[model samples]
Target: MFCHSMTNSMGEIMKKDKLVFKSVLLTSASFAGYNIGSGFATGVEALQFFAAWGGKFAFSGIFLALLTSMAVLIAIYVIGFEQRFVKSSDVYHYFCGKYFGIVLDYYIYVSMIFVTFTMMSGAGATISQHSGLPAFAGASIMGILCFVTAHLGLERLRKALSYLCICTVLFVLFCGGYAFLTSGVSPIAGSANSEHYVSMGLMLRANTFGIQNPYLSGLSSAGLLIVSGFAWASATGSLCNSKREAVFSGIFSSLFFYMTTAVVVYLVLTSMDHVAGTEVPMLAVVHFLLPKLSVIYSIIIILAIYSTISGRLFLIAKRYDRGNKAMGFVIILSITILAIVGASLISFSKISNVVFSIMGAVGIIVCIIVLTRFIIAETMPKQLL
Candidate 1:
């Protein structure tokens, strides 16, 4: 009874001291920045895992969004609450052991480093894919730009880049809404097949390779969404530095994301009569809906890729030695080299699945560890694990 009363009192205090609206908005924007990347804006990812290869598995995306929002909300709330006790540096330590925490921290550092390189490569690829620049050349220039901008630190980078991603997403949503209003909606031709595939449990783990078993697929999907949320929440917490701020930001940003993606799904699904594959569905939709706006979208794609690269670079800088001159040189040099190699070996169309697969597994374990700690802290005594 005492514990229950204490729990209730804590909840009331938390609710009363909830994240302010302004802080929440900032947090959500940061989270949005993390969530909207190459695979997100292009719809290639949606097509591969959720739409085409998944065989009209439309509901999977919805499920993904739902699960992602829930996990993120929890993560953000925990991070926000923990701000009094733990800074961003100790978030991992609180989740896992000191050894495990260090491992996870370094893993996060490595992941951010790689993610920075990949984003730079992706920027160049987007330019090559859209403009006439060679992918290699594009990668080099992008890597340079990212390294320069990342030096400015998180405050400046987030202020500048968040708008870029947010604007592009808003544009896409506005266009999608317009398209839907004008053309009207229609069901997928093989909706039954997609539904059946989902029902049969293939859609959850529908890979480029083949259908995974029901159990594995379900778990994989669950894992991906959860990690996405955790990663997003960590980024959010870093931005807001409070639990209430993270929660509110997560809630608003997630709503915006869902609405935006829902519009994309509608636009892409409706335009299938005119466009088939998922690879360039956005381009197709743009070409079909407003031919004159092609250049605008091309720019948007390039900027979206840029925002991601810059954000990742800043993340890497923060994780590594923020003040060390040698670390900056290393980050720049390493990322540039990796970008060149990445450009040579991988195309967004080719390597997204593999990257997500490896990252997804690691992300899930991290998220679970963090979430378990949060739950225990909230519910149990410190004496218990």
Candidate 2:
């Protein structure tokens, strides 16, 4: 009965059902893969939020991953709704529209395009930092690649693009491991910064490079991580269905996120001193720990960026196909312009913040509406029971 409800055939259900353990692992990795780009992969974000607070913050990151898992559950259930409601993947339209539906649809669509653009710009910046590639060139290459992928329908691209996430984990682990073996520890793991420790009785508090107050700092970081996860899961929820599936997938995905992020953060903190002040903390560590490996990892980082850009494009195209052309065209154009703006003014960390902020705003609204609708629908009886 469960299988039938999932899909018409076993094959179809298999495609939609929580992937097998291994595939789920890969999918989760892909989810995080695109989710974490230059700033994330390089520990710039971890530094600001996680590593800046020192070892104490790692636990916060783990907890945030758990929240991400919850968001994934919400997303999966939305996907199931997509299958049932519209018989299409155009999940945004169902929720956003009033009478015409185009108003909200345009908003969602534009938001998606902006997201993809920002992602591509970020990839370019990462490549510049890691590989010495021209940032514009790198961004252009990645953008074009994503454009091609978007031209294809999403159903064909989802599985293929997911591999990028898996590859990202393996590359980070391999590079970070090598750094750990050779570089040895520095200060970040439980080492108290004098500034953070000595900042008692000050008006605004003494300044520190990393965390000023460990406990409060950790909580703030955790909030950012969970907020980031929520934005991502809510935006992608249309692809998943079933509360059980959403919850399970979220748990699985968050586990990978926290584990991998912890290792990378640790590696960065131990090998590179003064990284907290740098624009690219992870790159500083890589450049210090193993220059040769940094080159290789740089390529992988570019690919990771591409993977996310591709996913965003595919989603936009899919959503556009289901809606009015006027709004759809506007969305695509606005996203293109937004990407260019981000490319000009933003770096990896800032772009990530924008992406997460947009996702957070859109996601919370969508989640409330969808969950409420689902509950109401399920409770209604033959005569409004």
Best candidate per lDDT, number? 1
Tens-place lDDT digits, model 1, residues 1-385? 9999999999987775664665666556655666566655765545444454332455555556456555646664566555533334476676777888788767766666555555555656666756667778777776676667667665676566567767877889788777867875553652335445445533322342244432333334335434443444664565565555556665676665556656666666666544453235566678788888877886776677666666666656556656787887687667767866786566655565565555555654665676677777778876875
Give all candidate RMSDs, comma-separated.
6.9, 7.1
The per-model lDDT (C-alpha) reads 0.60, 0.55
Candidate 2: residue 344 Cα off by (Å): 2.7
How well does candidate 2 score on lDDT at residue 22?
47
* Ten-residue stretch with the least lDDT total in model 1: 201-210
Where model 1 places Cα greater than 4 Å from the true spot, the runs are: 1-19, 53-56, 84-89, 185-187, 190-232, 235-242, 273-279, 382-385
